[model samples]
Target: MKNHSGHDMAGHNGHGGARPGGLSVSENGYTLEFDSTIFSAGAQTVTFRVTGPDGRPVTEYTPEHEKELHLIAVRRDTAGFQHVHPVMDEKGTWSTVVTLEPGDWRFFADIHPAGHDGTMTLGIDASVAGPYDPRPIPEATGIARIGEYTVALGGELLPGEASELTLTVSRNGRPVTDLQPYLGAYGHLVALRVGDLGYLHVHPEGAPGDGSTEPGPEVTFMAAAPSGGTYRFYLDFQHNDVVRTAEFTVRTTAVPRPDTAPGTAPGHTNHHHAHH
Candidate 1:
């Protein structure tokens, strides 16, 4: 690919090295454009378009995990985590509604064009119109409760290697066994490192209706940290025709590096919520 200057695109260097997504608003040939970046506190609608290599709105997309795209939004302080699916029109514009608090927020658009080589996660910053008093980071925990559900996490999150995380859900001291299918699965999980909110794309172990997959009590997924740091995990599950999210805080064990010591800060968080 070449522009008027006949230079290769920076993101398509041909090396094919695997990298994380959702860190930038534009990458390779895809861009996440929003209608407005400023919003007042409360429920509001967000409209955006994804432009591909040709600089036109991307209208053709292959659905991944039962949807054309997934939008993940969160406040800078790791509060108000939301994963929503938006509907796209013939004009290639997508829209969704989100609840906003008084703080900075990041919106990640995870999409895969019909003819594109791979999926891309483009992110843009959004500001809420109000007094900005960011929340402080909380202590790491393995247990999280949302509504009437309590989820207990099992397994480790290590840097540089795929780790299996098993989350068991129960309500009122009784294990939930009849979880409804959400997005073609029993659950959907999103992991983001605390500071930068770098997105970690995770895959569930199995989908609903699979012969070996069960609907309830436990949902398994595979996730790897980009680096050793404190991270936030949000899991969405459906039951009784309602969906709720359970948030968990966990830290990964650092991977040894030759140049850096075991306790280096390069790939770790200082616990401060940095505004991007």
Candidate 2:
């Protein structure tokens, strides 16, 4: 839901248009207005409201993926990424607590109003006051290690289409077969473009309770990329009653030119980087 915009083409991400969610404060008559954009570095409750075209609070929203709204906050350097759901009051104010550090932050609100025809993802920036030490962005990788778990990614991403992606989970080099369900699925995958932190729509292939879906070792997802570029993927899965996320950075494959001879490589290439 974070990628909706007239300019948002899941397969053609680089086309010029309205930026992805978290890049604009207002879109399509809906505004993502926060009570304050400057906050102290610590645990704090951030409050924001959505105003409709009529300049009034929007109180009714249709739920997507079992949540009315998804809030994603990440540091500019991609050092900190947190996806949380906020509670809304009658006044259309949504509030949630998040730990902040010194630096710039990006906030993406993915929502769909009850009366609206489709979902809208709006973006805004918040400045955290403190010693702003920036973090460096790492190279793309297909593997990520969190604690004792290791996740290996397989499959290629093509623009303008739902690419099949398979994620395998292991612990201490042993395959995990009893993974618990997270958010009604065996796993949840989030894709964000490298430069702008543009959110991409990613859907899991099947549900946890489905007879054909397995609990662990292999979790499949269908992801669409708007353009060829560096993209970071986060997979959330639960094992041993603990939930953890695996991070991987990948580049989409390039299309072969019509004039290019057979077996000739295209101008674009794919790269994978694993985060430890």
Candidate 3:
């Protein structure tokens, strides 16, 4: 039985009635459980649970991006991408089984609580038990100008390793300021790794205050690639009541880290060489 507040208000499968408190999945972190035993070669069943922050059952919460909860899963090497709708069973547990391949993958849970200012983001990395090299990042290219935005990209990302992307947006051949708010954040960036088009939803770091009346021109986004492979990036922004989009193609390469000299950090980019 689903509650009017959008929370599953029923008991099921050894689980009791709706309880208070939010669910978490990290050890030494939140209490939500991500049971992966349901995963298999072809058809897979995955179950997750959620609660409130006060240890009580979460009845009704705010919906972000038009959904109560958005779960995005993708194989580590850009093999599979699934945007799933999880059903909240009577016992307050959300479960869904998807057909998938055996490989390393990552999962992201996007949640927004009622009366909260921003959405809560969480991620988990898992392996399907196979031969995989979770190194090397992807490279991004095909940057084009869309209206007042200039977008460029590069990088290759493997599973588990953090994917760092640098997007430079400008207007009038100069850095743009006065960026307007779009999608509850400064900017909205959507990434789909090639082959399967796995989805990576991201938002900018800074946002305008609640009562500020401002507009914008240029924006930048730093996003993590969820897996290794070629990825397509779409950045959306608004100006003068019109929305603009910038597209770029990025390739992920599996290059091992070089042994730097003593006192030199790893993976550091030297901008001086590019300028010369």
* Model 3 regions more than 4 Å off: 1-30, 129-139, 143-200, 203-276
Please name the candidate that would achieve the greatest lDDT relative to the true structure.
1
**TM-score of every prediction relative to native:** 0.85, 0.83, 0.44
* Candidate 2 wrong stretches, greater than 4 Å: 1-22, 253-276
Please give the distance, in angstroms, between residue 157's alpha carbon in candidate 1 and its true position after superposition.
Answer: 0.3
Estimate, for each residue in 1-276, the C-alpha lDDT of model 2 and write its tens digit. Answer: 123322223323332122334557787799999999999999979999899989998999988777888888888777678888999999899999999999999888988877887787888889999999897667667788998899999988765444468999999999999998876788877778788887764556667787999887999775556556777777778898887988887887546435445653332222211100
Deviation of model 2 at 44, angstroms: 1.8
The root-mean-square deviation over C-alpha atoms between each candidate and the true structure, in angstroms, is 8.2, 5.8, 13.3
Measured on C-alpha atoms, candidate 1 has an lDDT of 0.77
Error of 1 at 4 (Å): 34
136, model 1: CA deviation in Å?
1.6
lDDT-best of 1 and 3: 1
What digit string (tens of lDDT, one per residue) describes model 3 on residues 80-165?
A: 55656677766657777766677776666666656655554455666564455543434444566876557555344332223344
Which scores higher on lDDT, 1 or 2? 1
